[model samples]
Target: MSETTLDTRTVPHDMDAEMAALGGMLLTPSAAADVAELLNAADFYRPAHQTIYRAAAALMDRGDPVDAISVNAELDKLGEINRVGGAPYLHTLAASIPTAANAAYYARIVADKALLRRLVETGTRVAQIGYTGEGEAAALVEDAQAEMMAITSGAEPEEDAFFRSFMPQVVAGIEDRANADTNLVGLPTGLNDLDELTRGFRPGQLITVGARPSLGKSTLALDMVRAASVNAEDPAPAAFFSLEMGRNELGERLLSAQARVAFTRIQAGTVDDADWARMAEAMPRINAAPVAVRDDVNDLRIIRSVCRRMKATTGLRLVVVDYLQLVETGERSENRQQDVSAVSGALKAMAKELGVTVIALSQLNRGPESRDDKKPRMSELRESGSIEQDSDMVILLHRDDFYDQESVRAGEADLFVVKHRNGPTATLTAAFQGHYARFMDMARG
Candidate 1:
């Protein structure tokens, strides 16, 4: 078709009317999702674009004036909006929309956005208006069309398909890093070797730290949680889901661990000057870390809900469930073993689903008691069915003293890696100070 004919046919007789219709069409909840999907697929923008748009919207919502140049500059300042190729795309973006999540968020003050909703009511009309027979306008319209198509296609970006296939690998990496950052909020245990071995309890790994009651399972987890939160090269925010202990009790334990006072001593409140001095030295660091504890939730659903809420607020990277048995799985089957399996499996799956590492403290079966050595094995993890299958790593806590005093007086506890699915299986030793709930490296065990 000739340019004139194409122009007449393509650009509606009333340009304003056509733009209005397209805007209305793209804004519907479903339509908006479709529009977002298409744009994401056709061209890639830095993940920070989402951040920039959200920031811009917040500014606009507060009636702040952010002209295109100023907005782009602000994004550059915050490292949100980076280099854009050619021209006005960045400028156009600032002018056209505000963003909440997947949709083009617009201020209600922009009367056109309300109108845009109506225009996007039907795919046929959007296709016609956006296709622009042939030009820059056509390109923009096509992107909008693609976004609509993506939404209509009923695909979730976070689902495996979109994350693995459509989104850039960088997004996955960024997400992983963010997840890690959120999970490592507690202090580091100053065990360099252990930190190097596991990258400070990574995101999306269900690590079962199980052993007999006195073998330091909770101590090890708390120490690692505290250490990881504080001593990370890049710290990840963390939430401790201590089903067995109340928040106050957990806090006291942490304070004791930091203060180097025996947990019993702290409880007894017989603090000497030295213990008080040590606590003064440690409490500030312990208190300032980005660690949070949750003990109120017990039901599996409630636990998951609490976890999700934590993820929302703190960008949780790691979750420590203090002793798995304490979690009431609520899967009322005849077999408690089966019930335990479901709970363990759900924890592992949660690690993968939320992309957060879960260091789950677990109680050992009488298997440890039966064994002469009493060091835990993979099979020794109580409810091995799901815990064994779901865990990426399993470290069984075993104090020789729990079995024999020579081990504790020797300052030795074995962290037996019974299952290292991604790595090697070996045993390492850390000095367990039960009094303070702290674990120091054995250095030479």
Candidate 2:
């Protein structure tokens, strides 16, 4: 074919497959259910096929008979009988296939063609956007990626495994855990008590760590990242999306924490011989760890896109969004609460979609300061009700010395697991080594 002819070719479709699928549905009720599970009316390329499929689906949904006669009458009632070639065409479809057992297979072919058509449409739209240069380059790229992701995600088969199908895997997992040396079922945080209480952070969980200003919520989250990526017996890839702090600042904090060097000394460029030695010893591990840090982008869509790419490339295990309030969804809402709600919901969805544990640091309201005990609570999560609703777990952080300098628990911090959806809620204490810019388990300290 010539280039012009190829360019002008009709979009992908398999009319035979559409007819076969519809014929199978007309032959048997089970075939109709099977086809419906894999495809909808839009998957048919022909308008007549679309109308016929819709009529049959409507009849099936109402528990009515789904034969050629019933479908023809239904289409006629909806004034679409002539549009779909009347009763004779319905008979042609019923005679098109020999057996209904292959209905799902035929539906699969139709669905695949529909997916390709969607892909072509998405490419056309993206090309138009590129031609127009209507938005920022980064935003446009993100929008294009979002469009492609939507098509691929929609094409994925629905998970319809029976309960019995899951028991074997569950038993295998139990046996594996029983045989393993560690008790952790998910990625571990370095803080031993918190890890024990939360059973580490499981996949598809949105764990919110909330604290007031200067209480070291960022420090705590970074410590978890270090644990998962750098300190574990078998370290996993991790990502840190720092919206409130710069990359350099985060690097300094991570280095100081890992080396047990003073953060102030690192900040002032006054590291002495001992600090230099510790940092040198820690450098190799930090460099080898598959940890990605991005300090520039705050848009949630871009962040999610980067994360999805990372998950595909490096097998990302944990994601840390340093404080949730600063994340922008790239769309303005009527109120700040709504914006935060959208951001949190997207973060939760990203965690599930990527199958990674997400530790989103959150800023707490002033509820702690007003209380006599100075302990943060779940209700104090800044900006939105959805934070608590969306999160699988919520940890509230508090430090004694932060409130009273001479208190007995001077260097101790309390992490209250206020909302653990899968486990009991409790408070755990850790050593807040502020100078080192990290938290340590009390026993280790």
Candidate 3:
């Protein structure tokens, strides 16, 4: 099409389809349910059609018949009779279609046209953004991608399947599990006991790992990443957003943990020959692992953008946020609790949207230290507004040696599963090797 023709073209809409859908619903009240599944008021291009559709939906919702008279009455009740062209328009719609059986088909057509219109609008907005050059080029691109993602995700047809329709898939999953050697599902954390108790971390799950300072929360998160990516029989792609640590620091920690070298020695630049050899041996596996790390970004929007990109490009299965307190929501609230709450909620939403397991590190408040028992509680999560509520699982790390150097469980850590939405809560013990900057299953240790 020529430029002028393209510019002059009307926005996408099918008046015939809209009228047919409405007529089908009015003719066959039962078809209202089918049409309602596909189209909403906003989907109609004409305001009158939108009003009519709303009236019909309201009548259906209230168990009232959805015919021309009832719909006209509904419009009159809402003081919109004149706006929708009076009773004549409702009668016209009722006779527009030959059969109500095609209501869903007409609704689908209307939905497609609405989706195309939205795409056109999105393209125009993106072009405007490009012309304005109002923000950083990278941020602008992120915004554009986000807009496109929203359109595409919203355009997806929701499946309203009954329980009988879902049984086949559920039974298949059960059979798969029964045939498998291990009962572990989802991504493994590499800790045998924890994996047994919680199964693996599932997609769309927001897992919180909380601890006081120097308690190896970050180490545990890295361990999970390593297990899922570098150490798995079939490695998967993973992402780590380190707001607290720099790229170099994370690399050093990962190397130390994977190589079983003393973190102190690596930090102090006192690595010996054996440590070098171990690191050399671990290098190939680390290089082969498809793990992406971002240390510069702190905003939750940018983090989510990166996750979406990774999910699209690499089929990302896991995401780890190093210590949630440092994450910003791009819009600060007066109350710090509200800010943290927003970040936590966004992280959870991101996990569900991207279908990835998100392990977010959190910090515990001083409530643990004030009590005789230094074990961190779910209530002690710093700015504990919605973190507990948002997370699918809340793991509180407690190392006895952190409080008492001479304690019996000196080299062990207790992972307190305070909140498990899908399973029972329990405390699991694992070997905490501080020197190596990693955690391991006690049996393996």
Question: What RMSD, rounded to one decimal, does every model reach?
Answer: 12.2, 17.1, 17.7
Highest lDDT scorer: 2
Name the best candidate (by TM-score): 2
Candidates 2 and 3 compared: the better one by lDDT is: 2
Candidate 1, 1-445: lDDT as tens digits? 5233222223113323222222322233332322322222112123334354444444433434434555566666666564442125554443343332323222221234323433444455556555565557867676667667753464555555655575677687667768774333223435655555654555678888888776667767777777677555656678788777788877888888777788888888898999899989988787767788887776776666556545544456778888787778766677778777878888988887677888888888887777687656677677656888888888887777766766535567777778877667777777777767788876564
Which residue ranges in model 3 land beyond 4 Å of their true spot?
1-157, 160-167, 443-445
lDDT of each: 0.62, 0.88, 0.88
C-alpha root-mean-square deviation, candidate 2: 17.1
Task: Give per-residue CA lDDT, model 2, range 1-445, as digits (tens).
Answer: 3222236879999999999999998888767767876788888999889989999888865657889989989999999999888899888998998888888789999999999999899988887777788879999999889888988676554554567767898899889989988889999989888778877899999999999998999999999989989988889888899988899999999999999999999999999999999999999999998999999889987788678656644568899998799998888677999999998999999888678999999998898889898888889999999999999999989998998998999999998999999999998889999999999988652
User: Any idea what lDDT model 3 has?
Assistant: 0.88
Ranking under TM-score, best-scoring first?
2, 3, 1
The lDDT ranking, best first, is 2, 3, 1
**What tens digits encode model 3's per-residue C-alpha lDDT throughout 1-445?**
3232248889999999999999988887556766876788989999999999999888865667778999999999999999989998888987888899888889999999999998999999898788788989999999999888877576554574467777998899889888988878789898988898888999899999999987889889999999899999988799999888898998999999999889999999999999999999999999999999899999887787677645543568999999799998888578889889998999899888677999999998998999787878898899956999999999999988889988988899999999999899999989988888899888752
Total clashing residue pairs per candidate? 41, 0, 0
lDDT of 3 at 371: 79
